[model samples]
Target: MFDDRASVATAAGMRLAQAGVRWDVVKVRRFLGLQAIEHIEQPGAVAVDPHSPEPMLYFFVPAGTLADWDVPDTRALNSTECTTHVVLPPGHREAPPGPYWLLPPSCGLTPTDTLHRALERALHRPDPHPHFRIDTAAMRADAAQLIGDAAELPESTVLPQLVQRLRGHLMVLVPHVEDRMRAFARTAETRLVAQVTVGEAQRRLNSVPGLTFISEIKHAQTLARSVEALCRHAEVPTHTVAKAPAPTVGVVQQ
Candidate 1:
Protein backbone atom coordinates (compact mmCIF):
# COMPACT_ATOMS: atom_id res chain seq x y z
CA MET A 1 0.00 0.00 0.00
CA PHE A 2 1.38 3.40 -0.93
CA ASP A 3 0.01 4.65 2.39
CA ASP A 4 3.39 3.65 3.72
CA ARG A 5 6.06 6.11 2.57
CA ALA A 6 8.58 3.41 1.72
CA SER A 7 6.07 1.62 -0.50
CA VAL A 8 5.00 4.68 -2.51
CA ALA A 9 7.63 4.51 -5.26
CA THR A 10 7.34 0.77 -5.83
CA ALA A 11 3.58 0.96 -5.70
CA ALA A 12 3.65 3.89 -8.13
CA GLY A 13 5.96 1.95 -10.45
CA MET A 14 3.75 -1.14 -10.41
CA ARG A 15 0.74 1.00 -11.19
CA LEU A 16 2.54 2.55 -14.16
CA ALA A 17 3.68 -0.84 -15.43
CA GLN A 18 0.10 -2.05 -15.37
CA ALA A 19 -0.76 0.81 -17.72
CA GLY A 20 2.33 0.25 -19.92
CA VAL A 21 3.57 3.77 -19.15
CA ARG A 22 7.27 4.48 -18.63
CA TRP A 23 7.14 7.86 -16.93
CA ASP A 24 5.43 9.55 -14.04
CA VAL A 25 6.18 12.94 -12.51
CA VAL A 26 7.30 13.95 -9.01
CA LYS A 27 7.39 17.22 -7.11
CA VAL A 28 11.02 18.53 -6.71
CA ARG A 29 10.98 19.22 -2.99
CA ARG A 30 9.36 15.89 -2.30
CA PHE A 31 11.90 14.09 -4.49
CA LEU A 32 14.67 15.79 -2.56
CA GLY A 33 13.02 15.63 0.85
CA LEU A 34 12.57 11.88 0.58
CA GLN A 35 16.35 11.64 0.34
CA ALA A 36 16.59 12.68 4.04
CA ILE A 37 18.54 15.81 3.13
CA GLU A 38 18.60 18.45 5.87
CA HIS A 39 18.74 20.94 3.06
CA ILE A 40 18.77 20.50 -0.70
CA GLU A 41 21.83 21.49 -2.76
CA GLN A 42 21.33 23.93 -5.64
CA PRO A 43 21.83 20.96 -7.96
CA GLY A 44 21.53 17.40 -6.62
CA ALA A 45 20.68 14.05 -8.12
CA VAL A 46 17.21 12.64 -7.34
CA ALA A 47 15.87 9.17 -7.94
CA VAL A 48 12.46 9.26 -9.57
CA ASP A 49 9.77 6.72 -10.25
CA PRO A 50 9.30 7.42 -13.97
CA HIS A 51 6.06 5.53 -13.79
CA SER A 52 4.43 8.19 -11.56
CA PRO A 53 1.78 10.04 -13.58
CA GLU A 54 1.29 12.84 -16.05
CA PRO A 55 0.22 16.28 -14.80
CA MET A 56 2.98 15.62 -12.24
CA LEU A 57 6.06 17.87 -12.30
CA TYR A 58 9.00 15.42 -12.09
CA PHE A 59 11.80 17.13 -10.10
CA PHE A 60 15.54 16.41 -10.47
CA VAL A 61 18.64 18.51 -9.82
CA PRO A 62 20.92 19.29 -12.78
CA ALA A 63 24.19 19.22 -10.79
CA GLY A 64 24.12 15.48 -10.08
CA THR A 65 23.99 12.16 -11.91
CA LEU A 66 22.29 8.79 -11.26
CA ALA A 67 25.28 7.88 -9.09
CA ASP A 68 24.24 10.51 -6.58
CA TRP A 69 20.92 8.79 -6.07
CA ASP A 70 22.18 7.21 -2.86
CA VAL A 71 19.32 8.59 -0.73
CA PRO A 72 15.59 9.02 -1.03
CA ASP A 73 13.67 12.10 0.03
CA THR A 74 11.73 10.87 3.09
CA ARG A 75 10.72 14.17 4.60
CA ALA A 76 7.02 14.82 5.04
CA LEU A 77 5.40 17.99 3.79
CA ASN A 78 2.63 20.35 4.84
CA SER A 79 3.01 24.16 4.80
CA THR A 80 6.13 23.70 2.65
CA GLU A 81 4.55 21.88 -0.30
CA CYS A 82 3.46 24.83 -2.42
CA THR A 83 6.62 26.83 -1.69
CA THR A 84 9.27 24.29 -2.67
CA HIS A 85 9.09 22.99 -6.18
CA VAL A 86 7.87 21.49 -9.34
CA VAL A 87 10.79 20.31 -11.82
CA LEU A 88 11.87 17.91 -14.55
CA PRO A 89 13.25 14.37 -14.22
CA PRO A 90 16.92 13.94 -15.13
CA GLY A 91 17.77 12.07 -18.35
CA HIS A 92 14.15 12.06 -19.35
CA ARG A 93 13.96 12.86 -23.10
CA GLU A 94 10.38 13.48 -24.15
CA ALA A 95 9.29 16.17 -21.67
CA PRO A 96 5.65 17.24 -21.89
CA PRO A 97 4.70 20.30 -24.06
CA GLY A 98 5.67 23.99 -23.67
CA PRO A 99 3.66 24.24 -20.50
CA TYR A 100 5.99 21.50 -19.18
CA TRP A 101 9.33 22.68 -17.71
CA LEU A 102 12.56 20.76 -17.25
CA LEU A 103 13.61 23.44 -14.83
CA PRO A 104 11.18 25.59 -12.88
CA PRO A 105 11.93 29.24 -13.53
CA SER A 106 14.04 30.97 -10.91
CA CYS A 107 14.47 34.70 -10.07
CA GLY A 108 13.18 37.05 -12.84
CA LEU A 109 13.13 34.70 -15.85
CA THR A 110 9.99 34.91 -17.95
CA PRO A 111 7.53 32.18 -17.08
CA THR A 112 7.81 29.30 -19.63
CA ASP A 113 6.64 26.30 -17.61
CA THR A 114 3.49 24.25 -18.07
CA LEU A 115 2.10 25.41 -14.71
CA HIS A 116 2.23 29.04 -15.78
CA ARG A 117 0.63 28.21 -19.13
CA ALA A 118 -2.02 26.09 -17.44
CA LEU A 119 -2.92 28.90 -15.04
CA GLU A 120 -3.16 31.18 -18.06
CA ARG A 121 -5.51 28.62 -19.60
CA ALA A 122 -7.46 28.29 -16.37
CA LEU A 123 -8.57 31.90 -16.67
CA HIS A 124 -10.24 30.81 -19.89
CA ARG A 125 -10.96 27.23 -18.87
CA PRO A 126 -14.60 26.33 -19.30
CA ASP A 127 -16.59 25.15 -16.34
CA PRO A 128 -16.66 21.35 -16.47
CA HIS A 129 -19.49 20.96 -13.96
CA PRO A 130 -21.18 24.28 -13.42
CA HIS A 131 -24.04 23.08 -11.24
CA PHE A 132 -21.87 21.15 -8.80
CA ARG A 133 -19.54 24.02 -7.99
CA ILE A 134 -19.81 24.36 -4.21
CA ASP A 135 -18.31 26.51 -1.45
CA THR A 136 -16.92 23.80 0.80
CA ALA A 137 -14.85 26.29 2.74
CA ALA A 138 -17.95 28.11 3.92
CA MET A 139 -19.64 24.84 4.79
CA ARG A 140 -16.66 23.81 6.90
CA ALA A 141 -16.60 27.19 8.60
CA ASP A 142 -20.23 26.85 9.62
CA ALA A 143 -19.56 23.38 11.03
CA ALA A 144 -16.63 24.70 13.04
CA GLN A 145 -18.81 27.40 14.54
CA LEU A 146 -21.47 24.86 15.48
CA ILE A 147 -18.97 22.61 17.29
CA GLY A 148 -17.28 25.57 18.91
CA ASP A 149 -20.58 26.66 20.42
CA ALA A 150 -21.35 23.12 21.52
CA ALA A 151 -18.05 22.92 23.37
CA GLU A 152 -19.11 25.78 25.64
CA LEU A 153 -21.82 23.95 27.54
CA PRO A 154 -21.92 24.57 31.32
CA GLU A 155 -20.04 22.05 33.41
CA SER A 156 -23.10 21.48 35.60
CA THR A 157 -25.00 19.84 32.76
CA VAL A 158 -24.78 16.08 33.08
CA LEU A 159 -23.55 14.25 30.00
CA PRO A 160 -26.50 11.85 30.04
CA GLN A 161 -29.05 14.66 30.08
CA LEU A 162 -27.22 16.32 27.23
CA VAL A 163 -27.38 13.10 25.23
CA GLN A 164 -31.12 12.62 25.95
CA ARG A 165 -32.02 16.06 24.64
CA LEU A 166 -29.81 15.79 21.58
CA ARG A 167 -31.19 12.39 20.59
CA GLY A 168 -34.81 13.45 19.99
CA HIS A 169 -33.71 16.47 17.97
CA LEU A 170 -31.31 14.32 15.94
CA MET A 171 -34.27 12.18 14.89
CA VAL A 172 -35.51 15.19 12.87
CA LEU A 173 -32.76 14.61 10.29
CA VAL A 174 -32.42 11.59 8.01
CA PRO A 175 -29.80 9.46 9.72
CA HIS A 176 -29.60 6.96 6.87
CA VAL A 177 -27.89 9.58 4.74
CA GLU A 178 -28.11 8.17 1.29
CA ASP A 179 -26.10 7.24 -1.77
CA ARG A 180 -23.46 9.99 -1.53
CA MET A 181 -21.47 8.10 1.10
CA ARG A 182 -22.01 4.76 -0.60
CA ALA A 183 -20.26 5.92 -3.78
CA PHE A 184 -17.01 6.48 -1.88
CA ALA A 185 -16.97 2.88 -0.72
CA ARG A 186 -18.02 1.21 -4.00
CA THR A 187 -16.22 3.24 -6.66
CA ALA A 188 -13.42 0.71 -6.78
CA GLU A 189 -13.96 -1.01 -10.11
CA THR A 190 -10.31 -0.32 -10.87
CA ARG A 191 -8.11 0.97 -8.09
CA LEU A 192 -4.54 2.14 -7.75
CA VAL A 193 -2.49 3.67 -4.96
CA ALA A 194 -2.21 7.16 -6.38
CA GLN A 195 -2.48 10.76 -5.33
CA VAL A 196 -5.86 12.38 -5.98
CA THR A 197 -6.43 16.08 -5.62
CA VAL A 198 -9.26 17.57 -3.55
CA GLY A 199 -10.81 18.93 -6.73
CA GLU A 200 -11.03 15.41 -8.11
CA ALA A 201 -12.55 14.16 -4.85
CA GLN A 202 -15.23 16.82 -5.02
CA ARG A 203 -15.83 16.17 -8.71
CA ARG A 204 -16.48 12.51 -7.95
CA LEU A 205 -18.52 13.20 -4.81
CA ASN A 206 -20.74 15.61 -6.71
CA SER A 207 -21.92 12.72 -8.85
CA VAL A 208 -23.46 10.91 -5.88
CA PRO A 209 -27.17 11.05 -5.19
CA GLY A 210 -28.51 13.41 -2.50
CA LEU A 211 -25.47 15.66 -2.93
CA THR A 212 -27.04 18.73 -4.50
CA PHE A 213 -26.79 22.14 -2.85
CA ILE A 214 -30.43 22.21 -1.84
CA SER A 215 -30.08 18.78 -0.26
CA GLU A 216 -26.94 19.84 1.54
CA ILE A 217 -28.59 23.00 2.83
CA LYS A 218 -31.52 21.05 4.17
CA HIS A 219 -29.11 18.67 5.90
CA ALA A 220 -27.18 21.56 7.36
CA GLN A 221 -30.33 23.23 8.65
CA THR A 222 -31.50 20.03 10.27
CA LEU A 223 -28.14 19.64 11.97
CA ALA A 224 -28.28 23.23 13.19
CA ARG A 225 -31.67 22.64 14.76
CA SER A 226 -30.36 19.57 16.55
CA VAL A 227 -27.34 21.44 17.86
CA GLU A 228 -29.46 24.42 18.95
CA ALA A 229 -31.72 22.07 20.83
CA LEU A 230 -28.69 20.64 22.64
CA CYS A 231 -27.52 24.09 23.61
CA ARG A 232 -30.99 25.07 24.84
CA HIS A 233 -30.98 22.01 27.09
CA ALA A 234 -28.50 23.78 29.35
CA GLU A 235 -30.94 26.60 30.25
CA VAL A 236 -34.22 24.66 30.16
CA PRO A 237 -36.27 27.79 29.48
CA THR A 238 -40.07 27.90 29.29
CA HIS A 239 -41.80 28.77 25.99
CA THR A 240 -44.22 31.71 26.42
CA VAL A 241 -47.46 31.26 24.45
CA ALA A 242 -48.93 34.23 22.58
CA LYS A 243 -52.41 35.17 23.88
CA ALA A 244 -55.31 34.29 21.52
CA PRO A 245 -56.66 37.27 19.57
CA ALA A 246 -59.86 38.81 21.07
CA PRO A 247 -63.05 37.75 19.23
CA THR A 248 -64.04 40.34 16.65
CA VAL A 249 -67.53 41.89 16.00
CA GLY A 250 -67.86 39.49 13.07
CA VAL A 251 -68.79 36.81 15.66
CA VAL A 252 -72.28 38.40 15.85
CA GLN A 253 -72.77 37.82 12.11
CA GLN A 254 -71.82 34.21 12.54
Candidate 2:
Protein backbone atom coordinates (compact mmCIF):
# COMPACT_ATOMS: atom_id res chain seq x y z
CA MET A 1 0.00 0.00 0.00
CA PHE A 2 1.12 3.55 -0.73
CA ASP A 3 2.32 5.56 2.27
CA ASP A 4 4.24 8.68 1.21
CA ARG A 5 2.93 11.12 -1.43
CA ALA A 6 5.65 10.09 -3.86
CA SER A 7 4.62 9.70 -7.51
CA VAL A 8 5.63 6.48 -9.24
CA ALA A 9 6.03 6.35 -13.02
CA THR A 10 5.47 2.55 -13.21
CA ALA A 11 2.01 2.74 -11.63
CA ALA A 12 0.80 5.64 -13.79
CA GLY A 13 -1.87 4.55 -16.28
CA MET A 14 -0.60 0.95 -16.21
CA ARG A 15 -3.04 -1.73 -17.24
CA LEU A 16 -3.51 -5.09 -15.51
CA ALA A 17 -0.20 -6.92 -15.17
CA GLN A 18 1.00 -9.80 -17.32
CA ALA A 19 0.67 -13.38 -15.96
CA GLY A 20 3.59 -13.04 -13.52
CA VAL A 21 3.03 -9.56 -11.95
CA ARG A 22 -0.44 -8.61 -10.59
CA TRP A 23 -2.42 -6.41 -8.19
CA ASP A 24 -5.03 -7.41 -5.64
CA VAL A 25 -8.55 -6.36 -6.60
CA VAL A 26 -10.80 -5.36 -3.71
CA LYS A 27 -14.46 -5.89 -4.57
CA VAL A 28 -17.11 -3.81 -2.87
CA ARG A 29 -20.81 -3.17 -3.36
CA ARG A 30 -21.45 0.00 -5.41
CA PHE A 31 -22.80 2.20 -2.63
CA LEU A 32 -20.14 1.13 -0.14
CA GLY A 33 -17.56 1.59 -2.85
CA LEU A 34 -18.74 5.15 -3.42
CA GLN A 35 -18.58 5.86 0.30
CA ALA A 36 -15.11 4.38 0.61
CA ILE A 37 -13.89 6.31 -2.41
CA GLU A 38 -15.17 9.58 -1.00
CA HIS A 39 -13.57 8.91 2.38
CA ILE A 40 -10.18 7.95 1.00
CA GLU A 41 -7.81 10.66 -0.19
CA GLN A 42 -5.92 9.78 -3.37
CA PRO A 43 -7.86 6.56 -4.00
CA GLY A 44 -6.00 4.73 -6.76
CA ALA A 45 -7.42 3.07 -9.87
CA VAL A 46 -10.99 1.87 -9.39
CA ALA A 47 -13.17 0.02 -11.89
CA VAL A 48 -16.93 -0.45 -11.92
CA ASP A 49 -19.31 -2.92 -13.56
CA PRO A 50 -22.39 -0.79 -14.09
CA HIS A 51 -24.33 -3.57 -15.84
CA SER A 52 -23.88 -6.26 -13.18
CA PRO A 53 -26.80 -7.83 -11.28
CA GLU A 54 -25.59 -6.21 -8.10
CA PRO A 55 -23.25 -3.52 -9.44
CA MET A 56 -19.72 -3.88 -8.12
CA LEU A 57 -16.57 -1.80 -7.60
CA TYR A 58 -13.05 -3.17 -8.00
CA PHE A 59 -10.35 -1.23 -6.22
CA PHE A 60 -6.82 -1.78 -7.40
CA VAL A 61 -4.61 -2.13 -4.38
CA PRO A 62 -1.03 -3.35 -4.19
CA ALA A 63 -0.56 -7.10 -4.59
CA GLY A 64 -0.99 -9.00 -1.27
CA THR A 65 -3.12 -6.26 0.35
CA LEU A 66 -5.74 -9.00 0.67
CA ALA A 67 -3.50 -11.17 2.82
CA ASP A 68 -4.56 -9.23 5.95
CA TRP A 69 -7.61 -7.39 4.46
CA ASP A 70 -10.42 -7.99 7.01
CA VAL A 71 -13.14 -5.50 5.97
CA PRO A 72 -16.69 -6.87 6.09
CA ASP A 73 -18.84 -6.97 2.95
CA THR A 74 -15.73 -6.61 0.77
CA ARG A 75 -13.72 -9.22 -1.10
CA ALA A 76 -10.11 -9.13 -2.28
CA LEU A 77 -8.77 -11.10 -5.20
CA ASN A 78 -5.37 -12.04 -6.55
CA SER A 79 -3.66 -15.03 -8.20
CA THR A 80 -3.65 -16.86 -4.87
CA GLU A 81 -7.29 -15.93 -4.06
CA CYS A 82 -8.87 -18.21 -6.64
CA THR A 83 -8.52 -15.69 -9.51
CA THR A 84 -5.59 -14.96 -11.78
CA HIS A 85 -6.71 -11.85 -13.65
CA VAL A 86 -9.43 -9.18 -13.74
CA VAL A 87 -10.62 -7.53 -16.95
CA LEU A 88 -10.37 -3.73 -17.14
CA PRO A 89 -11.22 -1.01 -19.63
CA PRO A 90 -8.48 -0.10 -22.06
CA GLY A 91 -8.93 3.64 -21.37
CA HIS A 92 -10.36 5.90 -18.68
CA ARG A 93 -13.69 7.51 -19.60
CA GLU A 94 -17.37 6.62 -19.54
CA ALA A 95 -17.11 3.49 -21.70
CA PRO A 96 -20.45 1.72 -21.59
CA PRO A 97 -21.48 -1.89 -22.42
CA GLY A 98 -18.67 -3.24 -20.23
CA PRO A 99 -16.69 -2.66 -17.02
CA TYR A 100 -15.04 0.77 -17.10
CA TRP A 101 -12.68 2.80 -15.01
CA LEU A 102 -14.49 4.72 -12.30
CA LEU A 103 -11.09 6.12 -11.26
CA PRO A 104 -8.23 5.54 -13.57
CA PRO A 105 -4.81 4.24 -12.55
CA SER A 106 -2.69 6.93 -10.92
CA CYS A 107 0.48 7.53 -8.94
CA GLY A 108 0.03 4.98 -6.14
CA LEU A 109 -2.05 2.08 -4.87
CA THR A 110 -4.86 2.66 -2.35
CA PRO A 111 -3.64 2.35 1.22
CA THR A 112 -4.95 -0.92 2.66
CA ASP A 113 -5.35 0.44 6.21
CA THR A 114 -7.14 3.55 4.93
CA LEU A 115 -9.46 1.45 2.77
CA HIS A 116 -10.28 -0.81 5.72
CA ARG A 117 -11.18 2.14 7.92
CA ALA A 118 -13.21 3.72 5.10
CA LEU A 119 -15.23 0.55 4.60
CA GLU A 120 -15.98 0.41 8.34
CA ARG A 121 -17.04 4.03 8.30
CA ALA A 122 -19.16 3.44 5.21
CA LEU A 123 -20.99 0.63 7.03
CA HIS A 124 -21.71 2.67 10.17
CA ARG A 125 -22.17 6.19 8.80
CA PRO A 126 -25.70 7.59 8.71
CA ASP A 127 -27.03 8.24 5.23
CA PRO A 128 -27.78 11.91 4.57
CA HIS A 129 -30.60 11.20 2.10
CA PRO A 130 -32.30 7.93 2.94
CA HIS A 131 -35.55 8.72 1.09
CA PHE A 132 -37.81 11.43 -0.29
CA ARG A 133 -41.08 12.98 0.90
CA ILE A 134 -43.42 15.36 -0.91
CA ASP A 135 -43.81 18.89 0.43
CA THR A 136 -47.61 19.39 0.45
CA ALA A 137 -47.79 22.61 2.47
CA ALA A 138 -48.52 24.79 -0.59
CA MET A 139 -51.20 22.41 -1.85
CA ARG A 140 -52.81 22.34 1.57
CA ALA A 141 -52.83 26.12 1.63
CA ASP A 142 -54.49 26.28 -1.80
CA ALA A 143 -57.14 23.79 -0.63
CA ALA A 144 -57.82 25.93 2.44
CA GLN A 145 -58.28 29.02 0.25
CA LEU A 146 -60.67 27.21 -2.09
CA ILE A 147 -62.64 25.89 0.89
CA GLY A 148 -62.90 29.37 2.36
CA ASP A 149 -64.02 30.84 -0.97
CA ALA A 150 -66.66 28.16 -1.36
CA ALA A 151 -68.07 28.93 2.10
CA GLU A 152 -68.67 32.58 1.07
CA LEU A 153 -70.63 31.64 -2.06
CA PRO A 154 -74.42 31.43 -1.92
CA GLU A 155 -75.62 27.75 -2.01
CA SER A 156 -72.17 26.67 -3.22
CA THR A 157 -72.54 23.51 -5.38
CA VAL A 158 -68.91 22.52 -4.86
CA LEU A 159 -68.08 20.32 -1.87
CA PRO A 160 -65.29 21.86 0.23
CA GLN A 161 -63.94 18.36 0.97
CA LEU A 162 -63.43 17.79 -2.76
CA VAL A 163 -60.85 20.55 -2.79
CA GLN A 164 -58.92 18.75 -0.03
CA ARG A 165 -58.97 15.51 -2.01
CA LEU A 166 -58.00 17.33 -5.21
CA ARG A 167 -55.15 18.98 -3.34
CA GLY A 168 -53.90 15.57 -2.24
CA HIS A 169 -54.06 14.26 -5.80
CA LEU A 170 -52.43 17.38 -7.18
CA MET A 171 -49.70 17.16 -4.56
CA VAL A 172 -48.91 13.68 -5.81
CA LEU A 173 -49.07 14.82 -9.41
CA VAL A 174 -47.13 18.08 -9.03
CA PRO A 175 -43.80 16.28 -9.03
CA HIS A 176 -44.56 14.94 -12.50
CA VAL A 177 -45.46 18.39 -13.71
CA GLU A 178 -42.26 19.82 -12.27
CA ASP A 179 -40.31 17.13 -14.06
CA ARG A 180 -41.92 17.94 -17.41
CA MET A 181 -41.39 21.65 -16.95
CA ARG A 182 -37.75 21.04 -16.13
CA ALA A 183 -37.34 18.80 -19.15
CA PHE A 184 -38.85 21.47 -21.37
CA ALA A 185 -36.50 24.04 -19.94
CA ARG A 186 -33.50 21.80 -20.53
CA THR A 187 -34.50 20.83 -24.06
CA ALA A 188 -35.25 24.42 -24.95
CA GLU A 189 -31.89 25.76 -23.74
CA THR A 190 -30.37 25.16 -27.25
CA ARG A 191 -27.23 23.77 -25.60
CA LEU A 192 -28.50 20.42 -24.28
CA VAL A 193 -29.87 17.57 -26.37
CA ALA A 194 -33.54 16.71 -25.91
CA GLN A 195 -32.69 13.03 -25.63
CA VAL A 196 -30.39 13.57 -22.65
CA THR A 197 -32.84 16.03 -21.07
CA VAL A 198 -35.56 13.37 -21.01
CA GLY A 199 -33.53 11.01 -18.83
CA GLU A 200 -34.05 12.98 -15.63
CA ALA A 201 -37.70 13.50 -16.47
CA GLN A 202 -38.15 9.78 -17.00
CA ARG A 203 -36.43 8.93 -13.74
CA ARG A 204 -38.71 11.29 -11.80
CA LEU A 205 -41.85 10.12 -13.57
CA ASN A 206 -41.11 6.44 -12.97
CA SER A 207 -40.14 6.94 -9.33
CA VAL A 208 -43.75 6.26 -8.22
CA PRO A 209 -44.91 2.80 -9.19
CA GLY A 210 -48.06 2.46 -11.32
CA LEU A 211 -47.77 6.14 -12.30
CA THR A 212 -46.82 7.25 -15.79
CA PHE A 213 -46.28 10.80 -17.04
CA ILE A 214 -49.02 10.70 -19.70
CA SER A 215 -51.55 9.13 -17.32
CA GLU A 216 -50.74 11.69 -14.63
CA ILE A 217 -51.24 14.52 -17.12
CA LYS A 218 -54.61 13.03 -18.16
CA HIS A 219 -55.72 12.83 -14.55
CA ALA A 220 -54.55 16.38 -13.92
CA GLN A 221 -56.57 17.59 -16.92
CA THR A 222 -59.68 15.81 -15.59
CA LEU A 223 -59.15 17.46 -12.23
CA ALA A 224 -58.72 20.85 -13.91
CA ARG A 225 -61.97 20.45 -15.88
CA SER A 226 -63.82 19.32 -12.75
CA VAL A 227 -62.49 22.29 -10.77
CA GLU A 228 -63.48 24.71 -13.58
CA ALA A 229 -67.04 23.34 -13.59
CA LEU A 230 -67.21 23.61 -9.80
CA CYS A 231 -66.00 27.20 -9.88
CA ARG A 232 -68.58 28.07 -12.57
CA HIS A 233 -71.42 26.46 -10.58
CA ALA A 234 -70.33 28.15 -7.38
CA GLU A 235 -70.21 31.56 -9.16
CA VAL A 236 -66.54 31.91 -8.19
CA PRO A 237 -64.38 33.97 -10.55
CA THR A 238 -61.93 31.91 -12.64
CA HIS A 239 -59.43 34.78 -12.37
CA THR A 240 -59.27 34.33 -8.60
CA VAL A 241 -58.26 30.66 -8.88
CA ALA A 242 -55.81 31.32 -11.72
CA LYS A 243 -53.95 33.89 -9.66
CA ALA A 244 -52.55 31.28 -7.27
CA PRO A 245 -48.96 30.45 -8.18
CA ALA A 246 -48.00 26.88 -8.90
CA PRO A 247 -46.94 24.95 -5.83
CA THR A 248 -43.25 24.05 -5.65
CA VAL A 249 -41.60 20.81 -4.56
CA GLY A 250 -39.33 21.03 -1.53
CA VAL A 251 -36.75 18.63 -0.17
CA VAL A 252 -37.29 17.61 3.43
CA GLN A 253 -34.18 17.40 5.53
CA GLN A 254 -33.49 14.29 7.58
Q: Quantify all predictions' global Cα lDDT against the true fold.
A: 0.26, 0.49
lDDT of 1 by residue, 89-174 (tens): 22222122222222222211111133223323333434312222222333333433335445433233342223322222222111
Give the TM-score (vs. native) of candidate 2: 0.45
Pairs clashing within candidate 2: none
lDDT tens readout by residue for model 2, 1-254: 32212222233342444211446678898767776765787787777776678778887776666777678888877666454655565554323345665565543578778888888987876532322222334344443443444433212234323432452333233332333333232323221332333343333322322245444434333443433322222221222232223334662211
- Model 1: weakest 10-residue lDDT segment is 15-24
Q: Which 10 consecutive positions of candidate 2 have the poorest summed lDDT?
A: 231-240
**lDDT of model number 2:** 0.49
- Model 2: how far residue 149 lies from native, Å: 40
How many residue pairs clash (N, CA or C atoms closer than 3 angstroms) in each of the candidate models, in the order given?
13, 0
RMSD of 1: 23.8
